[model samples]
Target: MNLPATGRRVLVSGASRGLGRAVAQAFATNGDRVAVHYGSREDEARATLDSLAGTGHVLVGGDLSDAAGAASIAGRAADGLGGIDVLVNNAAVNLPHPLATTEYKQWAALWQQHVSVNLLATANLCHLAARRMIDAGTGGRIVNIGSRGAFRGEPDHPAYGATKAAVHALGQSLAVSLAPYGIGVASVAPGFFDTERVAHRLSGTEGEAIRAQSPFGRVASAEEIAAAVLWLASPSAEWASGAVLDLNGASHLRT
Candidate 1:
């Protein structure tokens, strides 16, 4: 697929580590200017910036739970990069909050946190980025990092699944609404990835069973997910807008 223009301004949320870090690196490697965003990991965010292949990358920090902060993040990234040409909503909270064992207060907190960060924040950024792209006539791209859990279900983390499902829906909606402006929006629903946060589980006793969930007998890699995001954001991927691509190694197929 053809890549975006050189120096294209891109913003990746939650880029302090793991999949987000990989996504930021992919854009930079493709010659795009990146904005690395983190929630509370300032040092890690700066490290991601330092690791980028090109210059002009910047770091943006904010709490997604605060609506204003989420908006501010998009605005700051746009200003830092001269204007945002792509948005990768990769930041999300996936806390395990099984209803069977969780107390009411904890369950409520989990729901609030997940929705605020995963769904609401993504929505806010989409709005901010789309508006700027429209006003500038740049016709940008927005790629959301959804999850297979949205379809297969997350029995232990209902909020995470629900928020991801909402993300797919939001992306589709934006794809239709923004098409007139040449903006393309899509989502990638990936299965468990071998990210640092999930490395322990992948090394535990249940690791084999988890790996066996996929026919390939392995979890997806962070770079694999980043590649999908990079392609979905490319100018050549305009025809793929409104798609919710499954990157689960056929582990969980949806009709």
Candidate 2:
């Protein structure tokens, strides 16, 4: 298959593993220079970097919980890749915090952690990246990895759901706010994916129930989500800005 013809400077956050790793590989395979960003897994991040098909791929590390560090990631990537043409905000946490079962204090702590990494950090990156893109006067693309739970609901991880919904909203708001500067912002809302983190669940007794959620009897693959992200980041997809493209397999439908 023909990779993207245009060689863009792409930065993918949380590229240490799973879906983020796949997204980075997709961009690199398509002839783009990639900056692989990781929060805590430097080894895995380097593995992702080395797995890329092309040259000029670099590994970036930072704690997403730190607002300053999150903002710095964009600049570091720009420096590493020469300039960033696409930014993929994929770093996130999905810790369980079921309101019905958790104490108020614990729930509050989880909420703070979720908000700091998923929303605040993501917002800061968007801001810094948009500014850089604007200053360059060159068009760019931003693809955020949201979740179907944002709409369908995540009772166990309400903060995750809420933040993802906000992320989708933030993308739409930035799409309009940054259009004049030639920056296109969009998001992908994916259902449960077959990543290392969820392998156990996918293979356990609950696995059948999970698969039954979709008629296809399967969950999404990292590559599948990566493809959607690549399309959204493509120049041809500029018209899709502000769109929250759903990657769920009819498991959760919204009006």
Model 2 lDDT on a 0 to 1 scale: 0.91
In model 1, how many backbone clashes occur?
A: 0
Model 1 agreement with the true structure over 23-66: per-residue lDDT tens digits: 99999999999999999999988889999997999999998778
- Candidate 1 residue pairs in clash (backbone atoms < 3 Å): none
TM-score of each: 0.97, 0.97
Q: Output the number of the lDDT-best candidate.
A: 1
Candidate 2: where is the Cα deviation over 4 Å?
A: 1-5
Q: For residues 1-255, what per-residue lDDT tens digits would candidate 2 score against the true structure?
A: 111446988989899999999999999999999999999899999999999998999888998788789777877899998887888999999999998899999999999999998999889888887787887778799999999999999999999999999999999999999888888899999998899999999987799899889888899999999999999999788889999999989998899
The 10-residue segment with the lowest total lDDT in model 1: 1-10
List lDDT for all candidates, in order: 0.92, 0.91
